[model samples]
Target: MTADTNTDLDTAQLPPPAEKSARALARARKRRSVARFWREYRTHRSGLWGLAGLILIALIAICAPLLVGADSQSVTDAPGGALEAPSGEFPLGTDQFGRSVLALLVWGARVSLTVGLLAAFLCVAIGTVVGIVAGHFRGWYSTVLMRVTDWFLVMPTLVLAIALATVMSRSIWTVILAIGVTTWPTTARLVRAQTLAVESRPYIERARALGGGHRHIMLRHVLPNVMPLVLAQTTLVISGAILTEATLAFLGLGDPTITSWGGMLQDAREAGAVSAGDWWYLAPPGLAIALVALAFTLCGRAIEAVLNPKLGVAR
Candidate 1:
Protein backbone atom coordinates (compact mmCIF):
# COMPACT_ATOMS: atom_id res chain seq x y z
CA MET A 1 0.00 0.00 0.00
CA THR A 2 2.93 2.37 0.83
CA ALA A 3 4.60 1.63 -2.56
CA ASP A 4 1.31 2.13 -4.49
CA THR A 5 0.67 5.41 -2.68
CA ASN A 6 4.17 6.71 -3.53
CA THR A 7 3.72 5.79 -7.24
CA ASP A 8 0.32 7.55 -7.39
CA LEU A 9 1.85 10.70 -5.83
CA ASP A 10 4.64 10.72 -8.46
CA THR A 11 2.11 10.38 -11.30
CA ALA A 12 0.01 13.22 -9.84
CA GLN A 13 3.09 15.48 -9.77
CA LEU A 14 3.57 15.13 -13.58
CA PRO A 15 2.36 18.01 -15.78
CA PRO A 16 -1.02 17.60 -17.47
CA PRO A 17 -0.82 15.87 -20.86
CA ALA A 18 -3.93 17.80 -21.93
CA GLU A 19 -2.08 21.13 -21.46
CA LYS A 20 0.79 19.90 -23.66
CA SER A 21 -1.71 18.73 -26.28
CA ALA A 22 -3.49 22.12 -26.23
CA ARG A 23 -0.22 24.00 -26.73
CA ALA A 24 0.73 21.74 -29.62
CA LEU A 25 -2.70 22.30 -31.14
CA ALA A 26 -2.31 26.08 -30.91
CA ARG A 27 1.08 25.92 -32.68
CA ALA A 28 -0.44 23.71 -35.41
CA ARG A 29 -3.23 26.23 -35.91
CA LYS A 30 -0.70 29.07 -36.33
CA ARG A 31 1.24 27.08 -38.92
CA ARG A 32 -1.98 26.19 -40.74
CA SER A 33 -2.94 29.87 -41.05
CA VAL A 34 0.47 30.73 -42.48
CA ALA A 35 0.29 27.84 -44.94
CA ARG A 36 -3.24 28.82 -45.96
CA PHE A 37 -2.16 32.35 -46.81
CA TRP A 38 0.68 31.10 -49.00
CA ARG A 39 -1.57 28.57 -50.66
CA GLU A 40 -4.10 31.25 -51.53
CA TYR A 41 -1.40 33.50 -52.97
CA ARG A 42 0.05 30.68 -55.07
CA THR A 43 -3.35 29.82 -56.48
CA HIS A 44 -3.76 33.34 -57.90
CA ARG A 45 -2.41 32.99 -61.48
CA SER A 46 -2.83 36.63 -62.47
CA GLY A 47 -1.24 37.83 -59.24
CA LEU A 48 1.73 35.50 -59.68
CA TRP A 49 2.33 36.60 -63.28
CA GLY A 50 1.86 40.24 -62.36
CA LEU A 51 4.34 39.99 -59.53
CA ALA A 52 6.82 38.28 -61.85
CA GLY A 53 6.47 40.94 -64.54
CA LEU A 54 6.79 43.81 -62.07
CA ILE A 55 9.91 42.26 -60.60
CA LEU A 56 11.42 41.81 -64.07
CA ILE A 57 10.68 45.44 -64.93
CA ALA A 58 12.16 46.61 -61.64
CA LEU A 59 15.26 44.56 -62.23
CA ILE A 60 15.69 45.99 -65.72
CA ALA A 61 15.18 49.51 -64.43
CA ILE A 62 17.76 49.00 -61.70
CA CYS A 63 20.34 47.56 -64.05
CA ALA A 64 19.58 49.68 -67.10
CA PRO A 65 22.95 51.27 -67.93
CA LEU A 66 24.83 48.09 -67.15
CA LEU A 67 22.59 45.86 -69.24
CA VAL A 68 22.12 48.24 -72.20
CA GLY A 69 25.63 49.80 -72.11
CA ALA A 70 24.51 53.31 -73.02
CA ASP A 71 23.13 56.52 -71.52
CA SER A 72 19.38 56.75 -72.21
CA GLN A 73 19.68 60.26 -73.66
CA SER A 74 22.99 59.91 -75.50
CA VAL A 75 22.26 60.58 -79.16
CA THR A 76 24.27 58.54 -81.62
CA ASP A 77 24.48 59.78 -85.17
CA ALA A 78 25.30 56.37 -86.60
CA PRO A 79 23.80 56.93 -90.07
CA GLY A 80 23.92 53.21 -90.85
CA GLY A 81 22.32 52.28 -87.49
CA ALA A 82 19.26 54.56 -87.65
CA LEU A 83 15.92 52.73 -87.40
CA GLU A 84 17.64 49.35 -87.19
CA ALA A 85 15.29 46.53 -86.15
CA PRO A 86 15.97 44.26 -83.16
CA SER A 87 19.33 42.54 -83.57
CA GLY A 88 22.21 41.04 -81.60
CA GLU A 89 23.74 44.45 -80.82
CA PHE A 90 20.43 46.18 -79.97
CA PRO A 91 17.85 43.67 -78.79
CA LEU A 92 14.96 46.12 -79.04
CA GLY A 93 16.50 48.09 -81.93
CA THR A 94 17.86 51.64 -82.33
CA ASP A 95 15.78 54.83 -82.30
CA GLN A 96 15.87 57.62 -84.88
CA PHE A 97 19.06 59.02 -83.35
CA GLY A 98 20.54 55.50 -83.19
CA ARG A 99 20.12 55.48 -79.40
CA SER A 100 19.46 51.96 -78.13
CA VAL A 101 15.72 51.49 -77.64
CA LEU A 102 16.30 48.81 -74.98
CA ALA A 103 18.34 51.29 -72.90
CA LEU A 104 15.66 53.96 -73.18
CA LEU A 105 13.00 51.50 -72.04
CA VAL A 106 15.05 50.30 -69.05
CA TRP A 107 15.72 53.87 -67.91
CA GLY A 108 12.17 55.04 -68.58
CA ALA A 109 10.79 52.27 -66.38
CA ARG A 110 12.73 53.73 -63.47
CA VAL A 111 10.97 57.07 -63.87
CA SER A 112 7.49 55.62 -64.33
CA LEU A 113 7.83 53.27 -61.32
CA THR A 114 9.23 56.00 -59.09
CA VAL A 115 6.45 58.42 -59.95
CA GLY A 116 3.80 55.75 -59.42
CA LEU A 117 5.06 54.62 -55.98
CA LEU A 118 5.71 58.14 -54.66
CA ALA A 119 2.37 59.49 -55.84
CA ALA A 120 0.51 56.52 -54.41
CA PHE A 121 2.19 56.95 -51.01
CA LEU A 122 1.30 60.62 -50.88
CA CYS A 123 -2.30 60.01 -51.93
CA VAL A 124 -2.80 57.15 -49.46
CA ALA A 125 -1.30 59.13 -46.56
CA ILE A 126 -3.46 62.21 -47.16
CA GLY A 127 -6.56 60.14 -47.81
CA THR A 128 -6.16 58.05 -44.65
CA VAL A 129 -5.81 61.07 -42.38
CA VAL A 130 -8.72 62.88 -43.95
CA GLY A 131 -10.85 59.74 -43.86
CA ILE A 132 -10.15 58.90 -40.21
CA VAL A 133 -10.87 62.45 -39.10
CA ALA A 134 -14.10 62.77 -41.03
CA GLY A 135 -15.42 59.29 -40.26
CA HIS A 136 -14.52 59.04 -36.60
CA PHE A 137 -15.93 62.47 -35.74
CA ARG A 138 -19.42 63.10 -37.09
CA GLY A 139 -21.58 66.28 -37.28
CA TRP A 140 -20.16 69.57 -38.64
CA TYR A 141 -16.65 68.23 -39.01
CA SER A 142 -17.75 65.33 -41.20
CA THR A 143 -19.99 67.56 -43.28
CA VAL A 144 -17.22 70.07 -43.92
CA LEU A 145 -14.63 67.48 -44.78
CA MET A 146 -16.97 65.53 -47.07
CA ARG A 147 -18.03 68.70 -48.85
CA VAL A 148 -14.40 69.51 -49.58
CA THR A 149 -13.93 65.98 -50.90
CA ASP A 150 -17.02 66.38 -53.06
CA TRP A 151 -15.63 69.60 -54.55
CA PHE A 152 -12.50 67.74 -55.55
CA LEU A 153 -14.57 64.88 -56.94
CA VAL A 154 -16.50 67.24 -59.21
CA MET A 155 -13.35 68.93 -60.54
CA PRO A 156 -11.72 67.80 -63.78
CA THR A 157 -8.57 66.15 -62.47
CA LEU A 158 -6.66 66.02 -65.78
CA VAL A 159 -7.44 69.66 -66.56
CA LEU A 160 -6.42 70.67 -63.04
CA ALA A 161 -3.21 68.64 -63.36
CA ILE A 162 -2.43 70.24 -66.74
CA ALA A 163 -3.04 73.69 -65.32
CA LEU A 164 -0.83 72.97 -62.30
CA ALA A 165 1.91 71.52 -64.49
CA THR A 166 1.67 74.56 -66.74
CA VAL A 167 1.91 76.93 -63.78
CA MET A 168 4.76 74.98 -62.22
CA SER A 169 7.91 73.71 -63.88
CA ARG A 170 7.31 70.74 -66.12
CA SER A 171 9.15 68.27 -63.87
CA ILE A 172 8.55 64.74 -62.60
CA TRP A 173 7.91 65.95 -59.05
CA THR A 174 5.32 68.42 -60.27
CA VAL A 175 3.53 65.68 -62.16
CA ILE A 176 3.64 63.39 -59.11
CA LEU A 177 2.24 66.10 -56.85
CA ALA A 178 -0.55 67.05 -59.23
CA ILE A 179 -1.68 63.48 -59.76
CA GLY A 180 -1.39 62.54 -56.04
CA VAL A 181 -3.32 65.57 -54.78
CA THR A 182 -6.14 65.16 -57.27
CA THR A 183 -6.47 61.40 -56.78
CA TRP A 184 -6.86 61.40 -52.97
CA PRO A 185 -10.54 62.34 -52.98
CA THR A 186 -11.65 58.90 -54.14
CA THR A 187 -9.46 57.12 -51.63
CA ALA A 188 -10.65 59.42 -48.86
CA ARG A 189 -14.30 58.64 -49.62
CA LEU A 190 -13.67 54.87 -49.67
CA VAL A 191 -11.70 54.95 -46.43
CA ARG A 192 -14.32 57.10 -44.74
CA ALA A 193 -17.08 54.68 -45.63
CA GLN A 194 -14.98 51.78 -44.32
CA THR A 195 -14.18 53.66 -41.11
CA LEU A 196 -17.86 54.43 -40.50
CA ALA A 197 -18.72 50.76 -40.88
CA VAL A 198 -15.91 49.63 -38.56
CA GLU A 199 -16.79 52.24 -35.95
CA SER A 200 -20.31 50.85 -35.63
CA ARG A 201 -19.11 47.36 -34.74
CA PRO A 202 -19.88 45.99 -31.25
CA TYR A 203 -16.24 46.03 -30.17
CA ILE A 204 -16.02 49.67 -31.12
CA GLU A 205 -19.07 50.43 -28.99
CA ARG A 206 -17.48 48.49 -26.14
CA ALA A 207 -14.30 50.48 -26.55
CA ARG A 208 -16.35 53.66 -26.30
CA ALA A 209 -18.17 52.30 -23.21
CA LEU A 210 -14.79 51.50 -21.68
CA GLY A 211 -13.84 55.16 -22.14
CA GLY A 212 -11.26 54.58 -24.84
CA GLY A 213 -9.93 57.83 -26.29
CA HIS A 214 -10.83 58.88 -29.81
CA ARG A 215 -7.28 58.55 -31.09
CA HIS A 216 -6.97 55.11 -29.54
CA ILE A 217 -10.13 53.85 -31.16
CA MET A 218 -9.29 55.44 -34.48
CA LEU A 219 -5.75 54.16 -34.74
CA ARG A 220 -5.86 50.80 -33.00
CA HIS A 221 -9.31 49.60 -33.95
CA VAL A 222 -10.35 51.52 -37.05
CA LEU A 223 -7.15 51.73 -39.05
CA PRO A 224 -6.17 48.05 -38.97
CA ASN A 225 -9.60 46.92 -40.12
CA VAL A 226 -9.64 49.33 -43.05
CA MET A 227 -6.02 48.78 -44.10
CA PRO A 228 -6.82 46.02 -46.59
CA LEU A 229 -9.20 48.26 -48.53
CA VAL A 230 -6.66 51.06 -48.46
CA LEU A 231 -3.94 48.78 -49.84
CA ALA A 232 -6.19 47.60 -52.68
CA GLN A 233 -7.09 51.16 -53.58
CA THR A 234 -3.43 52.14 -53.50
CA THR A 235 -2.60 49.61 -56.24
CA LEU A 236 -5.25 51.09 -58.52
CA VAL A 237 -4.07 54.61 -57.76
CA ILE A 238 -0.48 53.67 -58.58
CA SER A 239 -1.53 52.38 -62.01
CA GLY A 240 -3.55 55.55 -62.64
CA ALA A 241 -0.65 57.75 -61.61
CA ILE A 242 1.69 55.94 -64.01
CA LEU A 243 -0.79 56.36 -66.88
CA THR A 244 -1.31 60.03 -65.99
CA GLU A 245 2.41 60.71 -65.96
CA ALA A 246 2.76 58.97 -69.30
CA THR A 247 -0.08 61.05 -70.75
CA LEU A 248 1.47 64.26 -69.48
CA ALA A 249 4.81 63.31 -70.91
CA PHE A 250 3.34 62.29 -74.25
CA LEU A 251 1.59 65.66 -74.54
CA GLY A 252 4.97 67.46 -74.34
CA LEU A 253 4.35 68.59 -70.77
CA GLY A 254 7.15 66.32 -69.56
CA ASP A 255 10.55 67.78 -68.70
CA PRO A 256 12.64 67.47 -71.82
CA THR A 257 15.71 66.54 -69.84
CA ILE A 258 14.12 63.46 -68.30
CA THR A 259 14.00 60.16 -70.18
CA SER A 260 10.59 58.49 -69.85
CA TRP A 261 8.59 55.86 -71.74
CA GLY A 262 6.17 58.58 -72.84
CA GLY A 263 9.08 60.80 -73.81
CA MET A 264 10.30 57.97 -76.03
CA LEU A 265 6.86 57.85 -77.66
CA GLN A 266 6.96 61.61 -78.18
CA ASP A 267 10.37 61.27 -79.78
CA ALA A 268 9.04 58.52 -82.03
CA ARG A 269 6.17 60.72 -83.14
CA GLU A 270 8.53 63.63 -83.77
CA ALA A 271 10.81 61.34 -85.77
CA GLY A 272 7.76 60.43 -87.85
CA ALA A 273 8.07 56.75 -86.90
CA VAL A 274 4.40 56.12 -87.60
CA SER A 275 4.41 57.83 -91.02
CA ALA A 276 7.81 56.37 -91.89
CA GLY A 277 6.77 52.78 -91.02
CA ASP A 278 9.32 52.57 -88.19
CA TRP A 279 7.11 50.34 -86.05
CA TRP A 280 10.01 49.35 -83.80
CA TYR A 281 10.26 52.87 -82.31
CA LEU A 282 6.65 53.00 -81.05
CA ALA A 283 5.81 49.35 -80.33
CA PRO A 284 8.23 48.48 -77.49
CA PRO A 285 7.47 51.38 -75.17
CA GLY A 286 3.72 51.17 -75.81
CA LEU A 287 3.74 47.45 -75.04
CA ALA A 288 5.77 48.06 -71.85
CA ILE A 289 3.35 50.68 -70.54
CA ALA A 290 0.37 48.44 -71.26
CA LEU A 291 1.98 45.42 -69.60
CA VAL A 292 2.89 47.31 -66.44
CA ALA A 293 -0.61 48.72 -66.09
CA LEU A 294 -2.13 45.30 -66.63
CA ALA A 295 0.13 43.81 -63.96
CA PHE A 296 -0.99 46.34 -61.39
CA THR A 297 -4.64 45.77 -62.24
CA LEU A 298 -4.27 42.02 -61.92
CA CYS A 299 -2.41 42.22 -58.62
CA GLY A 300 -5.02 44.55 -57.20
CA ARG A 301 -7.83 42.23 -58.19
CA ALA A 302 -6.05 39.29 -56.63
CA ILE A 303 -5.54 41.18 -53.38
CA GLU A 304 -9.21 42.10 -53.29
CA ALA A 305 -10.12 38.45 -53.77
CA VAL A 306 -7.83 37.37 -50.94
CA LEU A 307 -9.15 40.03 -48.60
CA ASN A 308 -12.80 39.38 -49.41
CA PRO A 309 -12.99 35.61 -49.81
CA LYS A 310 -16.80 35.68 -49.68
CA LEU A 311 -16.76 37.49 -53.02
CA GLY A 312 -15.31 34.38 -54.70
CA VAL A 313 -12.91 31.47 -54.29
CA ALA A 314 -9.78 32.34 -52.31
CA ARG A 315 -7.12 33.73 -54.61
Candidate 2:
Protein backbone atom coordinates (compact mmCIF):
# COMPACT_ATOMS: atom_id res chain seq x y z
CA MET A 1 0.00 0.00 0.00
CA THR A 2 2.78 2.39 0.84
CA ALA A 3 4.53 1.57 -2.46
CA ASP A 4 1.22 1.93 -4.26
CA THR A 5 0.89 5.34 -2.64
CA ASN A 6 3.94 6.43 -4.68
CA THR A 7 2.27 7.85 -7.71
CA ASP A 8 3.08 5.99 -10.86
CA LEU A 9 5.37 8.08 -13.07
CA ASP A 10 3.10 9.56 -15.71
CA THR A 11 4.86 8.18 -18.73
CA ALA A 12 2.26 9.62 -21.09
CA GLN A 13 2.85 13.10 -19.66
CA LEU A 14 6.63 12.76 -20.14
CA PRO A 15 7.38 14.43 -23.44
CA PRO A 16 8.85 12.20 -26.04
CA PRO A 17 12.24 13.29 -27.32
CA ALA A 18 11.86 15.69 -30.23
CA GLU A 19 12.21 13.10 -32.94
CA LYS A 20 11.94 14.24 -36.54
CA SER A 21 8.98 13.07 -38.59
CA ALA A 22 9.80 10.51 -41.24
CA ARG A 23 9.58 13.13 -43.97
CA ALA A 24 11.85 15.48 -42.07
CA LEU A 25 14.37 12.74 -41.45
CA ALA A 26 14.25 11.79 -45.11
CA ARG A 27 14.81 15.41 -46.14
CA ALA A 28 17.78 15.72 -43.79
CA ARG A 29 19.29 12.53 -45.20
CA LYS A 30 18.80 13.87 -48.73
CA ARG A 31 20.53 17.09 -47.82
CA ARG A 32 23.47 15.17 -46.43
CA SER A 33 23.64 12.93 -49.49
CA VAL A 34 23.52 15.90 -51.84
CA ALA A 35 26.30 17.57 -49.88
CA ARG A 36 28.40 14.47 -50.15
CA PHE A 37 27.71 14.13 -53.85
CA TRP A 38 28.67 17.76 -54.48
CA ARG A 39 31.88 17.29 -52.52
CA GLU A 40 32.73 14.30 -54.65
CA TYR A 41 31.75 16.07 -57.87
CA ARG A 42 33.97 19.06 -57.18
CA THR A 43 37.06 16.87 -56.97
CA HIS A 44 36.85 16.22 -60.70
CA ARG A 45 39.37 18.54 -62.39
CA SER A 46 37.80 18.32 -65.83
CA GLY A 47 34.44 19.04 -64.27
CA LEU A 48 35.78 22.15 -62.62
CA TRP A 49 37.15 23.40 -65.92
CA GLY A 50 33.85 22.59 -67.60
CA LEU A 51 31.94 24.48 -64.95
CA ALA A 52 34.20 27.49 -65.42
CA GLY A 53 33.75 27.40 -69.16
CA LEU A 54 29.98 27.14 -68.86
CA ILE A 55 29.89 30.10 -66.48
CA LEU A 56 32.06 32.13 -68.83
CA ILE A 57 29.86 31.31 -71.80
CA ALA A 58 26.73 32.17 -69.85
CA LEU A 59 28.25 35.50 -68.81
CA ILE A 60 29.23 36.27 -72.40
CA ALA A 61 25.70 35.52 -73.47
CA ILE A 62 24.18 37.67 -70.75
CA CYS A 63 26.45 40.64 -71.42
CA ALA A 64 26.34 40.42 -75.19
CA PRO A 65 25.37 44.04 -75.90
CA LEU A 66 27.75 45.56 -73.35
CA LEU A 67 30.75 43.50 -74.44
CA VAL A 68 30.33 43.84 -78.22
CA GLY A 69 28.47 47.18 -78.61
CA ALA A 70 26.74 45.75 -81.66
CA ASP A 71 23.11 44.96 -82.28
CA SER A 72 22.69 41.29 -83.16
CA GLN A 73 19.24 42.00 -84.52
CA SER A 74 20.37 44.80 -86.82
CA VAL A 75 21.16 43.87 -90.40
CA THR A 76 22.36 47.32 -91.53
CA ASP A 77 24.32 48.85 -88.65
CA ALA A 78 27.43 46.65 -88.79
CA PRO A 79 30.60 48.63 -88.11
CA GLY A 80 32.20 47.16 -91.18
CA GLY A 81 29.89 46.33 -94.05
CA ALA A 82 30.01 42.80 -95.50
CA LEU A 83 32.52 40.20 -94.32
CA GLU A 84 35.19 42.55 -92.97
CA ALA A 85 38.20 40.65 -91.68
CA PRO A 86 38.73 40.53 -87.93
CA SER A 87 40.41 43.73 -86.68
CA GLY A 88 40.37 46.33 -83.95
CA GLU A 89 36.98 47.88 -84.85
CA PHE A 90 35.06 44.71 -85.61
CA PRO A 91 36.65 41.66 -84.08
CA LEU A 92 35.35 38.27 -85.39
CA GLY A 93 34.62 40.01 -88.67
CA THR A 94 31.21 40.65 -90.32
CA ASP A 95 28.45 38.61 -91.92
CA GLN A 96 27.00 39.02 -95.41
CA PHE A 97 24.40 41.60 -94.24
CA GLY A 98 26.95 43.75 -92.36
CA ARG A 99 25.92 42.27 -88.97
CA SER A 100 28.78 42.19 -86.50
CA VAL A 101 30.11 38.66 -86.24
CA LEU A 102 31.05 39.33 -82.62
CA ALA A 103 27.54 40.47 -81.80
CA LEU A 104 25.95 37.62 -83.72
CA LEU A 105 28.15 35.19 -81.86
CA VAL A 106 27.24 36.79 -78.54
CA TRP A 107 23.51 36.83 -79.21
CA GLY A 108 23.67 33.37 -80.70
CA ALA A 109 25.07 32.20 -77.37
CA ARG A 110 21.84 33.33 -75.76
CA VAL A 111 19.74 31.33 -78.24
CA SER A 112 21.78 28.14 -78.15
CA LEU A 113 22.07 28.13 -74.38
CA THR A 114 18.42 28.93 -73.97
CA VAL A 115 17.36 26.10 -76.26
CA GLY A 116 19.65 23.60 -74.53
CA LEU A 117 18.48 24.49 -71.04
CA LEU A 118 14.78 24.71 -71.81
CA ALA A 119 14.79 21.52 -73.85
CA ALA A 120 16.67 19.66 -71.16
CA PHE A 121 14.21 20.96 -68.60
CA LEU A 122 11.36 19.69 -70.72
CA CYS A 123 13.01 16.29 -71.10
CA VAL A 124 13.67 15.99 -67.37
CA ALA A 125 10.17 17.04 -66.45
CA ILE A 126 8.53 14.62 -68.85
CA GLY A 127 11.00 11.82 -68.29
CA THR A 128 10.85 11.98 -64.50
CA VAL A 129 7.09 11.68 -64.39
CA VAL A 130 6.95 8.87 -66.92
CA GLY A 131 9.80 7.04 -65.32
CA ILE A 132 8.38 7.22 -61.82
CA VAL A 133 4.96 6.11 -62.88
CA ALA A 134 6.30 3.23 -64.97
CA GLY A 135 8.72 2.05 -62.32
CA HIS A 136 6.36 2.20 -59.39
CA PHE A 137 3.13 0.93 -60.86
CA ARG A 138 4.39 -2.28 -62.47
CA GLY A 139 2.24 -4.77 -64.44
CA TRP A 140 0.06 -3.25 -67.14
CA TYR A 141 1.02 0.35 -66.35
CA SER A 142 4.72 -0.35 -66.63
CA THR A 143 4.23 -2.58 -69.65
CA VAL A 144 2.30 0.03 -71.58
CA LEU A 145 4.63 2.85 -70.61
CA MET A 146 7.74 0.84 -71.38
CA ARG A 147 6.36 -0.22 -74.71
CA VAL A 148 5.61 3.35 -75.67
CA THR A 149 9.02 4.43 -74.49
CA ASP A 150 10.60 1.68 -76.49
CA TRP A 151 8.73 2.77 -79.55
CA PHE A 152 10.31 6.16 -79.27
CA LEU A 153 13.63 4.65 -78.37
CA VAL A 154 13.89 2.57 -81.51
CA MET A 155 13.62 5.62 -83.72
CA PRO A 156 16.82 7.57 -84.33
CA THR A 157 16.70 10.76 -82.28
CA LEU A 158 18.30 13.04 -84.85
CA VAL A 159 16.21 11.77 -87.73
CA LEU A 160 13.00 12.08 -85.75
CA ALA A 161 14.01 15.52 -84.60
CA ILE A 162 14.62 16.58 -88.16
CA ALA A 163 11.26 15.24 -89.24
CA LEU A 164 9.51 16.97 -86.36
CA ALA A 165 11.31 20.22 -86.94
CA THR A 166 10.28 20.11 -90.57
CA VAL A 167 6.66 19.58 -89.59
CA MET A 168 6.75 22.30 -86.92
CA SER A 169 7.51 25.93 -87.49
CA ARG A 170 11.15 26.93 -87.73
CA SER A 171 11.33 28.82 -84.44
CA ILE A 172 13.46 28.61 -81.33
CA TRP A 173 10.55 27.27 -79.30
CA THR A 174 9.73 24.78 -82.00
CA VAL A 175 13.30 23.59 -82.03
CA ILE A 176 13.14 23.19 -78.29
CA LEU A 177 9.96 21.17 -78.58
CA ALA A 178 11.39 18.95 -81.29
CA ILE A 179 14.55 18.16 -79.41
CA GLY A 180 12.76 17.68 -76.11
CA VAL A 181 10.28 15.26 -77.57
CA THR A 182 12.91 13.29 -79.43
CA THR A 183 15.39 13.20 -76.54
CA TRP A 184 13.10 12.17 -73.67
CA PRO A 185 13.05 8.49 -74.53
CA THR A 186 16.62 8.14 -73.36
CA THR A 187 15.93 10.13 -70.22
CA ALA A 188 12.82 8.14 -69.52
CA ARG A 189 14.74 4.92 -69.86
CA LEU A 190 17.49 6.09 -67.52
CA VAL A 191 15.10 7.53 -64.97
CA ARG A 192 12.95 4.44 -65.03
CA ALA A 193 15.94 2.25 -64.28
CA GLN A 194 16.91 4.45 -61.37
CA THR A 195 13.34 4.61 -60.15
CA LEU A 196 13.12 0.86 -60.23
CA ALA A 197 16.24 0.58 -58.11
CA VAL A 198 14.92 3.16 -55.68
CA GLU A 199 11.50 1.53 -55.48
CA SER A 200 13.11 -1.75 -54.52
CA ARG A 201 14.81 -0.33 -51.45
CA PRO A 202 13.60 -1.31 -47.97
CA TYR A 203 12.45 2.18 -47.09
CA ILE A 204 10.06 2.14 -50.01
CA GLU A 205 8.57 -1.12 -48.75
CA ARG A 206 8.25 0.44 -45.31
CA ALA A 207 6.56 3.44 -46.85
CA ARG A 208 4.13 1.12 -48.58
CA ALA A 209 3.42 -0.75 -45.36
CA LEU A 210 2.83 2.48 -43.52
CA GLY A 211 -0.28 3.18 -45.59
CA GLY A 212 1.44 5.69 -47.81
CA GLY A 213 -0.47 6.16 -51.04
CA HIS A 214 1.27 5.79 -54.40
CA ARG A 215 1.35 9.53 -54.93
CA HIS A 216 2.76 10.13 -51.48
CA ILE A 217 5.41 7.48 -51.79
CA MET A 218 6.42 8.23 -55.35
CA LEU A 219 6.62 12.01 -54.97
CA ARG A 220 7.93 12.03 -51.41
CA HIS A 221 10.33 9.14 -51.62
CA VAL A 222 10.94 7.78 -55.12
CA LEU A 223 11.48 11.01 -57.05
CA PRO A 224 13.89 12.47 -54.52
CA ASN A 225 16.03 9.35 -54.54
CA VAL A 226 16.28 9.24 -58.32
CA MET A 227 17.10 12.95 -58.80
CA PRO A 228 20.86 12.50 -58.92
CA LEU A 229 20.62 10.20 -61.90
CA VAL A 230 18.05 12.44 -63.52
CA LEU A 231 20.31 15.44 -63.03
CA ALA A 232 23.32 13.73 -64.54
CA GLN A 233 21.28 12.52 -67.46
CA THR A 234 19.90 16.03 -67.93
CA THR A 235 23.40 17.45 -68.17
CA LEU A 236 24.33 14.98 -70.86
CA VAL A 237 21.11 15.70 -72.63
CA ILE A 238 21.78 19.44 -72.62
CA SER A 239 24.94 19.06 -74.65
CA GLY A 240 23.06 16.87 -77.10
CA ALA A 241 20.19 19.32 -77.20
CA ILE A 242 22.55 22.17 -78.03
CA LEU A 243 24.14 20.14 -80.77
CA THR A 244 20.75 19.27 -82.17
CA GLU A 245 19.71 22.90 -82.22
CA ALA A 246 22.90 23.90 -83.97
CA THR A 247 22.45 21.16 -86.53
CA LEU A 248 18.89 22.19 -87.17
CA ALA A 249 19.91 25.82 -87.56
CA PHE A 250 22.77 24.92 -89.79
CA LEU A 251 20.40 22.99 -92.04
CA GLY A 252 18.14 26.01 -92.46
CA LEU A 253 15.37 24.47 -90.36
CA GLY A 254 15.76 27.18 -87.74
CA ASP A 255 13.83 30.41 -87.53
CA PRO A 256 15.23 32.80 -90.11
CA THR A 257 14.77 35.77 -87.82
CA ILE A 258 16.69 34.47 -84.79
CA THR A 259 20.47 34.92 -85.01
CA SER A 260 21.88 31.71 -83.56
CA TRP A 261 25.26 30.09 -84.11
CA GLY A 262 23.57 27.65 -86.42
CA GLY A 263 21.95 30.55 -88.22
CA MET A 264 25.36 32.18 -88.57
CA LEU A 265 26.67 29.00 -90.11
CA GLN A 266 23.65 28.78 -92.36
CA ASP A 267 24.18 32.36 -93.47
CA ALA A 268 27.81 31.65 -94.01
CA ARG A 269 26.93 28.70 -96.17
CA GLU A 270 24.41 30.73 -98.14
CA ALA A 271 26.81 33.63 -98.52
CA GLY A 272 29.65 31.37 -99.68
CA ALA A 273 31.70 32.10 -96.56
CA VAL A 274 32.86 28.52 -96.52
CA SER A 275 34.18 28.78 -100.09
CA ALA A 276 35.08 32.50 -99.95
CA GLY A 277 37.75 31.96 -97.27
CA ASP A 278 35.97 33.68 -94.40
CA TRP A 279 37.60 31.46 -91.82
CA TRP A 280 36.94 34.07 -89.17
CA TYR A 281 33.16 33.72 -89.49
CA LEU A 282 33.33 29.99 -90.11
CA ALA A 283 35.63 29.14 -87.22
CA PRO A 284 34.31 31.34 -84.41
CA PRO A 285 30.72 30.06 -84.29
CA GLY A 286 31.79 26.50 -84.97
CA LEU A 287 34.42 26.70 -82.26
CA ALA A 288 31.98 28.30 -79.85
CA ILE A 289 29.49 25.51 -80.43
CA ALA A 290 32.13 22.81 -80.06
CA LEU A 291 33.72 24.34 -76.97
CA VAL A 292 30.39 24.86 -75.23
CA ALA A 293 29.30 21.34 -76.02
CA LEU A 294 32.63 20.01 -74.81
CA ALA A 295 32.27 21.89 -71.55
CA PHE A 296 28.88 20.34 -70.89
CA THR A 297 30.17 16.92 -71.91
CA LEU A 298 33.04 17.16 -69.49
CA CYS A 299 30.74 18.26 -66.69
CA GLY A 300 28.29 15.49 -67.49
CA ARG A 301 31.06 12.91 -67.45
CA ALA A 302 32.18 14.23 -64.09
CA ILE A 303 28.69 14.00 -62.70
CA GLU A 304 28.37 10.47 -64.06
CA ALA A 305 31.65 9.60 -62.44
CA VAL A 306 30.46 10.84 -59.08
CA LEU A 307 27.04 9.19 -59.25
CA ASN A 308 28.26 5.98 -60.78
CA PRO A 309 31.75 5.40 -59.47
CA LYS A 310 32.28 2.47 -61.80
CA LEU A 311 32.48 4.97 -64.66
CA GLY A 312 35.28 6.83 -62.90
CA VAL A 313 38.18 4.61 -63.88
CA ALA A 314 40.52 7.61 -64.07
CA ARG A 315 39.19 9.09 -60.87
Q: Which lDDT value does model 2 have at 289?
A: 92
TM-score of each: 0.85, 0.88
Estimate, for each residue in 1-315, the C-alpha lDDT of model 2 and write its tens digit: 555445445544555555436667779998998899889988999998999999999999999879876565676665568888988877788888777788888999999999999999998889888988998998999999999999999999889989999998778899999999888888888888988888879998998899999999988998878887988888888998999999999998999988899888899999998889999889998999999999998898899899889875354
Residue pairs that clash (backbone atoms under 3 angstroms), model 1: none
Candidate 1 lDDT tens digits, 1-315: 699999999999987999879999999998997788668777899888988998998998888778766545677544237888888877888898788887788889999999989989998989998998999999999999999999999998888888888899988999899888888999999999999999989999999899999989998999989998998888878888888888888888888888898888999999899998888889988898889999998888887787778768434
**Best TM-score among the predictions, by candidate number:** 2
Give the per-residue Cα lDDT of candidate 1 at 268: 93
Query: How high a TM-score does candidate 1 get?
Result: 0.85
Winner by lDDT: 2
Per-prediction backbone clash count: 0, 0
For all candidates in order, the CA lDDT equals 0.87, 0.87
Which residue pairs in candidate 2 collide?
none
lDDT of 1 at 243: 87
Cand. 2 TM to true fold: 0.88
